[model samples]
Target: MIFVVTPKIPHFLHFTYGSRPSFSSIHSKNSATSLASTLKSISSSPSLISHGQQLHCFILKSGLNFDVFIQNSLINMYSKTGMFSCARSIFESSPTLDCASFNIIISGYLKNGRLGDAYKLFEKMPLRDCISYTTMIIGFAQNECYEDALALFREMRLLGVVPNEVTMQSVLPAYARADGTRINAMLLHGLVAKLGLDMNVVAWNVMLNGYVKGGLVDLARDLFDEIPGKSTYSWSTMIGGYLQVGRLVEALALYCEMRRTDSRPNEVMLIHIVSTCAQATRLLEGRQCHALALKMGMNFHDFMQATLIHLYAACQQVELAYLLFQEGTKDDIPCWNALIAGLMRNGIVNEAARLFSIMPQRNVLSWSSMISGYAQNGKHRLAIEVFHEMVGKGFKPDETTMVSVFSAISGLCALKEGRWAHQFIRCNSIPINDKLSTAIIGMYAKCGSIDSALEVFDQIRDKARIVNPWNAIIYGLAMHGKAEASLRIFADLQSRKIKPDSITLYGILSACCHAGLVEEGKSHFRSMTAEYGLEPNHKHYRCMVDLLGRAGRLNEAEELVQNMPMEADAVTWSTLLAACKMYENIDVGERAARNLARVEPSYGPGRIALSNLYADAGRWNDAFLVRRAMHNENLARSLDCGVSRLCNALDLT
Candidate 1:
């Protein structure tokens, strides 16, 4: 005989056995309670399948095979063992199923990253509970399906499912990941308040983190202040929030406050504080943090060492960074890369190269840093060589690496390499973000391919609606002597409400100079300070001097150079001298030449310009004297190149 009892609970079934005869007497001797206990014990064992199979066989033989209790245990064991198919097979083989069975299979699908299957099983469920909804919501959040997570949260609320703390925790982070979800975050905060969970520290921290990530630091700070008993995570989140918005002073102040409190600083807090110091350029504060780390015995830790290296490097103390790098373990890649990048930033290329050669391991960052460093420091050939070497080493280049390579190609005016990079980007389906698009435009422009540059500019115009590509296009057009087109682009930029920075004004002024638009250049120069609030830097001053000098306003150019707030550089003097040579103005030309020679005695181009100015005026003796000075300075080769350029400019070959 057999007996079955249906419990008052919604989804639980209990089975019991009475005396049985013949083959069914195997487990009939043992009670159902004892058998269920045995099955649970088997589920906990290390080798689940072997023990579970024995239990299943005994259940079948003992005539208690259809017990829901035993079947549920089997599903759990299979799921735990990562045998989802077996769990599903058991669920399907069962004649009766409940919410518990569906929940097990759905969770198994989620665990195995089979979200589609999980959702499918969930949709087919005859009954759903809080656990079912919460599981799916958490799964969506974990997978970065934030919209789906929030949508489900709303639906859960609509269906009168009162969410517990876990549901709120799962859904809050989804809002934090996106900027447009701030309103949703605030609404959730209100819901938490209505649910009387606002006082909960975990809830408070989640809300604070969401606000911080949404770029609402003030709101985050307000909420943070309301938390009576803040946790370490709360303090760190606030500090990181301030740091994210570049409120370095507030971040430091908060750190100081955190130190005064009973809560001790942890690794996460220390890392953020060190970063704050670096951003604020507070070397003294950074040293204090370093001392604290040492006192806490975290100095030699790989992550702490990397942060310290970055801090010292940002403070322009490369030697300190190097010392830390050398003192730390050699196997840490981040430490090595930080030191290498620091050396490169300080223009210590040879040392950086030496370190790169001996790096225990190299990643994309190492190669990208080396390539970018060489390109920025004007070692374009070496940069290109390193890029090709990185490719040869089978390291796939990311966007940053490609950007550096394109910049180097631009510097060398290597059209072939530039074309190949563009093709590679397309073939690899690399997203043409604004930075890469600007780099591509610059490469084409600098390589004397204005049409190609313009074409790229038009292609990315709709998507890359930023100032960088505009600057690149305008500068390229200016370089190619399309002054009108450059100005037209500048006008369009203003019409689009895209404010021009100093680089944009410089490009405009340069276009004016190239097109001999003196009055236009003067007006734009004045507007740089008045309209755009951009004070004329040295480059702007040089452009103005060149403009005035080229228009034969020699006296005004000289006066402008003399009265300029900043000291004129060698390029400024050279530009005036070149203009004088073009116009054969010996009086002002001699003054400009004298200044140029004094400022850059070794600069062969200036000397050649002065010589050509004399030659144009038939001053053969003076021209010969300039050549003799070039010989005296051992700049004969540079003089030869300069003379060739001068001859082409003056039609005097």
Candidate 2:
């Protein structure tokens, strides 16, 4: 509320804030403490830096800038606002500098990401205190020099400077992010307890986050239950951690518990819950969450709206999802992306594309949404086209977008384009993780470059981290008719003690099918339940039926299908019937054709195979009868009509 009394002083005081600086108050300003407090308050906000500079003019007018406290405050204000030269000028002008003077400048440098400069200044300090050590430690930690941060903390402890809650808070993240074997959550918990910081919710929250990031959700949950007077961050962090690690049921339960508590809830917790319900396709719970958000007046938040849309789309309630999107602000790009992603998730790609075309404004995420949607729906040409269009428009593709683009490239089997995409990922310096590795390896394999795929697989420094690349290589080898080589890779996967998932089993079974390795396929199928403890899903059962039927083990294949836990799908019967036609087995062929008819009555291939089997078995009347039935059902179509199916052609010849 300082007012300008003189015309020489800027009129912003009067014109902007409707006040003027009073010279009488300036003349009577005697208390340096009061002036320092005023300076601190004015300079604390980054938005008020202009006002802070104007106040400095008044301080100099009154000759109070000579005060060491006033000098230090000015340095802090300048440094906080990124005016390092101005801050350093004030520090150099101070005739007498205290430890606080160095602390302010050093903290400013650290905050500005000038870690080396902060360290240089720290080394020159004539004397240091706990706050000085804490500032440097926090600086190193924030700058991701985690080891240095922890080392400094140890030195601080050795110097007998007892740690405070802030110190514990600063150092806990370093421990959490450190090598897991070197850390014990209990050791830090005991240290925090010994410091009587158990009630320090921030410290506890940090510890909870540490445990979650370390992949020890059980420990995090134990600490979460022990936390007294939890904050919104506490609930949000725990719920988010639970969701991140795939503990959906528990996360939902915890949200219900949070709602039962007397404490106020934040928008983040509900958003996460709604998003989780979407992922799980729990439409009932998602609707309940929507009702809760409305009750708490949280539904209007942008994230909540987007997540509600995602929830509806995931559950196949696309109409409701689009209705929700239309009911809200269409100007919001994230909600639009969410709706588009939802459509893609529900297999409504054309609707997603239509909405994307008309968006008033689009961010990088919008383009990425279309790219990812097109890739997911097997519209590979559209995916690549949109990607080039986005690039032409000057939007750089992020990792997720590149992954989708690579998938599209793989679908086209464009080796040159795939190589360019791989080079682009490297040139852009995108860190190659498991999913990216899977995508890149798959791209190379599908593009008719198995050698490049193998090179990529071998270059993975830590291949044992996940079975993703291994699965890709195995499946790719199988697809390339290198079934024995694929089996060898599977053997290596098992030798490394890497647990093969259902997809891994699928790849192994596919290798066996491709090579007609009946005994090996049967062994692996048994090991699925006995060794790996993974129950065979429909894909596994289907692959096995194909393997046995291809091997001419018609009786064994039929038995396997008969004993299947679930009803046989059309593809399973088609596989068996095709094998029967190849082997001229009338009994199994007739049974498979009947089952295929029951499952997919409009399918023509099953009838064609049956007629072919009858003709091979010299049953002309039966073959003629099958052809008549197909014609009656309108299954007899023109040869010119092109086939329609997924573009993911797993041609494991």
Clash totals in order: 0, 4
Off by over 4 Å in 1: 1-254, 261-285, 313-319, 346-360, 590-653
Per-residue alpha-carbon lDDT of model 2 for 1-653, expressed as tens digits? Answer: 01111213322223344344454564565667655655565554566577677778988987888888888878876876768889999887788899999998888787777899989999999988888888998888776677898898888878888877778877776776653343455676678788785357777788678767766677778778878889878888888888887788788788888879886678877887888888889998889889999999888788899999999989999899989998998789889999999899878888888999999999889999999898888899989999989989988888788888988998788899889888988887878888888999999999889999999998982544778889999999999999988998888888873579988999999999999999999999999999988999889989998998988999899999989999988889889999999999988877776677667765667667777888999988777776665555456642211111100111101
- Worst 10-residue lDDT window for candidate 1 reads 1-10
In candidate 2, which residue ranges exceed 4 Å CA deviation? 1-223, 226-234, 241-250, 326-331, 344-358, 461-464, 495-498, 631-634, 637-653
- Tell me which residue pairs clash in candidate 2: 3-20, 3-21, 4-20, 4-21
> For candidate 1, lDDT tens digit of each residue in 542-613?
999989988899889999998888778779988888889889998888777666655555567777788888
- Candidate 1 residue 335 Cα shift, in angstroms, is 1.4
lDDT of 2 at 340: 91
TM-score of each: 0.60, 0.65
Model 2 residue 8 lDDT score: 37
